[model samples]
Target: MTASTLDAPSAGPADTTKVKRAAIASFLGSMLEYYDFYIYASASALVFGKVFFSKADPAMGTLLALATFGVAYIARPVGAVLLGHVGDRVGRKRVMLLTLVLMGMSTFLIGCLPTYAAVGVFAPALLVVLRVLQGISAAGEQSGANTLTLEHAPFGRRAFFTSWTLTGTQAGFILATVVFLAVAGLPDQTLLSWGWRVPFWCSLIVVALAYIVRRRIDEPEVFQAEQQTRQVAKLPVVELFRTHAADVSRVLLCAFIAVCSTVFSVFGLAFATSHEVGLSKTTMLLVAVSANVLALVTQPTLAVLADRIGRRPVFITGVLGCAVMIFVYFKAIMSGNVPLIFLAALVLIGFCYSAPNAVWPSFYAEMFDTRVRFSGIAIGTQIGFAAAGFAPTIAWTLIGNSRTNWLPVAAMVAVCCAISALSAATARETYRVPLTELGKRH
Candidate 1:
């Protein structure tokens, strides 16, 4: 094994108050950031086709709408490099608060955008613009939150603490899905006209709540001391590549596991509620809400387990399990058997997928030192996640003659999961590495 940091740099110990503050801030910030992001996902699946792409055939319009959803991924890598630089160079706290404000403004503006009928092609064009902004905001949110929380956390418990960043994201996904579930229940005319906008408009409220909670978190002590000593990297991305290139590449490949998540949540929702499947929007939405609620519970437990064992074992288990479980999960969805769909969703999303989701914040971040942890994770994961951000659209295109024939889509997920598992298997185990010693070459 490589030796830990000895002479490169050193920093202060954790504080109880700061640890609590960082986790709370990370949770609420993640909740708010993803709430803004997923609301767009829900809208693309349920309402955007009719509102913004009505000129096309129904099936084609849904395809076009989902295409717009993928547009955000194009901007995420750009955001990752830019915001990741700010987080690593300036301070994590600054980027944390900046992302929340940007997401709030963009999301609420999406609520106010005119329909295609009102403005011809400009409607979809403007929607894509705002969606790009959301993508940029998200690129930095979790990486900053994870870096901040991990720095503030007690020794030997970093995984447990860093895991909350993802748990907050689950809460955000649940809250966004529940709001859409209610809005999805409205009359078609009313739903297409205004119900969808309400969720986007409500993003302002989430922003305010997260601001109050997030503002209380100070910069991590290690980061502060490094800056005061003028030891911070001048360009985090360049330094990351020069010193930690292999880890960054590994994280990019490992992030392919997110394909399982987007396929299960976004494409699965669209498929179930399509005319071919004939499942109720309410039923599909409820399946999502229930599965996510279970994730909120299981993710933290899995994170604690990673702390006890090792990050690689826990992460590898989740990746391999998701590869197999995705087939079963979709098989149940295609069957139109309500009980079976619920059971499969609970297992695939709640436990199997949740394992990697829970552990990845720490698992990936531990690969780099404080100088480039945020940049390493943001650039690597966002580029990899670009595949996930577009997975729904790809899966939709992968569908065969009948939407019910979803075996091809399941096969696609298994391919991604396999690649992700292989990438993760090569990563160095870091659950036992001290925060100060991480990423240092002995």
Candidate 2:
């Protein structure tokens, strides 16, 4: 049978039940994956320096801690290649299960690690190892989840269904910020001694619950039929690059938009709460939590709009909107006005940022046939995401001794957003493309 014929669901009404199940599974799995990720982000910004790099000067230690955060991105590309192969070849369901377990275990081990005071060099070394594992797992989580959800969704609603994968990420960020917000309010000694680890440890419970939900999800019927028909590529990465290089390049550039996320969620947190900026840690964390909470509401709505309109207009709008809003958000942080900070963050992250964040799942996945969709997205996004991993460190260096001058950081975000939007503008509008027709050469 042809690929399209294999991809068609049995002749019947759409299985709304399976679609909803896939959405929930994708959401919970993504939520757990990002919760593990963002907690490390929160700790790196607020506590990792004190816990694992206390020997360095305060500024140097914070930079080192943030650098460790980037270390995972290095591993992500590697994981993307390896796990993306599994998702594309073996099964998306298998890759999803494996990634979740790896992330949960690595995060839990991070909580159990000894501090620098106890283990000296061994402490940071171990932290880097665990971070690498987290990176690898994360590389596969979103792409696999997005591919699964998109394939399972009914025609014309792909954006809305797949958006839940990222919406779960917003939930994860909010959940992480809330946990850290509580820990940030603890006595300094208490926070440093044990509070920071609590969130990482709590990951175990969520991981268990996600595991249960994901286990119940059947492999998408399209994927199963593709397997039965032997349409799966022998090497998905090779097929992906050979057939869809431009699409992969576009996804890579579009992925740079993640710099906006790291800046807002990671570097911005450190910048605002630094001694020079004089904002409270809990307050900054709350800003992140509130903005992401709003995104949880706005993203799916925006995805529905993208389905009705087109991915390009919706995504480009968000990218350009973020370009403008980054300046306002950072300026508000520098202004020390708590009310202004919340307002700008809400606009920047909650609304503007949510646009691309919501749409990219379906947008990027649409660029590849199901045979290589997982690898295409994972490889492209992971490569671009490596920069996001280190963006906080880059911002730190750019703003040296000039905490008040937020221009460099804002400029960096503006440039990244501009490139992402320009690249996205070149993409074929896939809002109306059939599932099996995506990525087919003309």
Candidate 3:
């Protein structure tokens, strides 16, 4: 564990007001950030092909769009290093502010970019640059937000509070998907022309609101205490690598479980609505929105369970459940069984995935001392998240416009989920450990 500093003034104990403020700050910030982020995912799946890649064949355009969406993941590790350094050395609060501004600017710019018809290849190139910026900004946002909230929270309430960050993500995703579903139904000419940009342009409003919420909160006492003690690492990225290599690897593998979340939410939505599947886009969108609502409710409940039992068990179970459920979920999608699809999405994404979604914030963050917790999580998880961010693209490539034959795609998702579950099983249980001794061996 990193040593505490005595040079600075002693901070007061964690209080309810501080805890609520921290959680709300993280939640609202993440909600906005993810709203911007999820809009792109929805666009990649539903709109980017028609608007940005009009030159390519229909199937190829959609694949290229999904590829652009995946390209952001490639920037995440870089962003993690840069922003993780800021969070650890400067302050989590400051890095968060910077991330918010970056994401907001990039997302808005994406809304304003020219289309393939107007600017040819330059349009997609500009889109890629903006997408990378969004990825970089997002890479640090959640980890920093979760860290701030966890450090501010009472011992037993860490999971309960940190869970809000993910709940916010679900809410953002729901909002984004619903908006896209509505806009997508416009007359083809209007929908293709300017309607799709509405969501991206609207991101400016969300970012501004998030800034107000996030800027009001102070750095958590735990980090402040570390700063006073001069235990803040000069290079958080390096320190994280040296001290918590195993934990980093474990987090990377565990993050693969997120493939379940991404593939089911984004790719499944696309697959169900594609001509092969013949389902209405609105039906798929409704299912996604409804399932996410259930997730918002279940995520906090699962997080509370982690606080009582342990993070590993909850995380492991969630991963396993997601892996097992995905096969049936895809089967339901292929069957064109509307009721089954709705129920499966709810059971899989809403309930099963929430186990890891709600708990992993604390589970991964607790794997390192405060000195490098941010980097350990940001880098490790982003590395694994690189795989997840590409999950839709991977599914696209595997399916290759073949929505009827989803067996192979389901297997790929299952494999990733299985790896995550096994990794979680191997990781140390941290719920019972004292805050100061969290990352160290007993």
Candidate 4:
């Protein structure tokens, strides 16, 4: 019920000041990074269909835009491998700084790209290139932030501390939705032309602030010790596979839980706003902003509960809850009940999905040793998240023209959440484990 009942620190108490700094850094950094990421998501849902794929029918153009959303996921695994190595072999702070700058630059450039009407096929091609860069930068952002924060946090409150990384993520989504909400109200031409680009351009300011905050933080002592003693893995990916292969495998499956998010955020938005659903773009964006706002509160609260209980029960329960809630959430949209959609969105994502989202930063990070924590979490989650990236396209394709086509999308979400839950069920309960003893094979 309290910190006193939880596992005591294996090492001496981490500097409380550093722990606070790490939490704030992780929070602000993830807020900015995912702000860059999700604004693309908002655009792909609302703006990119017209901007880059106008040659296709509106429906097909939307699909192509969603496919471009998946393009980033394709590069995410590669980024994870590359950036994970840097984070593990170099230092957490370096990867943190590098990822922020990369995301900011790529997102800003996306704002500057020419549209399909202006540049022919090269429009989407250029979009894909920058999207891939965004993906790569994203590969390292959360894992880097989670690892840095987890390592710095006192043992008893690791979940609470690491949870800020995801809390910031919820804030990012809210911020993006709010920004998009403002731009979405512009007249059609302006909305599509220069209005959407404003959000992308705004990422520069976020990047500058996050970089400044991150620059002041130091790497965790555990990591610095690895460097001073030359114990940093020469190839963290290899070390991760050799030592923690099962954990990595489990985490990849567990990370499938992200499908719930993409389904709720990106796909759900597209579906709700489509002609069939007839919801206004602003309405759907409001649903998103509302749920994410609730997530800001729920994630931290549930994360505190995770520390008091254990990660597995809370995470597994939440995943299963999502499986059920997503079905209801989609049904709410299909019914064209605004009040119902709002409730479902709040519960499905704000609470049920937020549980797993809040916990995974600490949950996944605890599955590896300090030497390979970044690589292991990065490589595993990014690969698994690729499924999430394409879930919108798959859901859209699955739920074809039938007005009742929402079932397949909901079912797809249920299945992924089920897989994620089962994976967590098998993981070691790390809440009670001393920080130094985490990831022990036997």
Q: Which candidate tops lDDT?
A: 2
Q: CA lDDT of each candidate?
A: 0.89, 0.92, 0.86, 0.91
Point to the candidate with the largest TM-score. 2
- Model 3 per-residue lDDT tens digits across residues 1-442: 2333211223555446887998998888988899999989888888899889998988889889989988999999999999899998999999989999999999999999999999899999999999999999989999899888877777677899989988989988988887788798998899889999999899889899999988899887778878888888997877787888999999999999878878877788778888888888788888889989999899999999999999988888888888888988988988888999999989998889889999999999888888888888899888999998888888888875455778777898889988998888888877766566667755
Cα distance off (Å), candidate 2, residue 126 = 0.4
Pairs with steric clashes in candidate 2: none
Local accuracy of candidate 1 as per-residue lDDT tens digits, 112-192: 999999999999999999989998998889989999998887766788888899999989999999999889999999999
| Model 2: per-residue Cα lDDT over 1-442, one tens digit each | 3446533435566657777898999999999889999999999999999999999998899999999999999999999999989999999999999999999999999999999999899999999999999999999999999999998887778999999999999999988888888888999999999989999999999899999999998888788888998989999989988998998889999999999999999999999989899899988899999999999999999999999999999999999999999999988888889999999999999999999999999999999988999999999999999889999999988898876678999999999999999999999998988888888888
Q: What's each prediction's clash count?
A: 0, 0, 1, 0
In model 4, which residue pairs have backbone atoms overlapping below 3 Å?
A: none
Model 4 scores worst on lDDT over the 10 consecutive residues at: 1-10
TM-score per prediction, in order, is 0.96, 0.97, 0.96, 0.97
Sort by TM-score, top down from the best: 2, 4, 1, 3
lDDT of 4 by residue, 362-431 (tens): 9999999888999999999999999999999998899877635888888888999999999999998898
Candidate no. 2 TM-score: 0.97
Which has the better TM-score: candidate 2, or candidate 3? 2
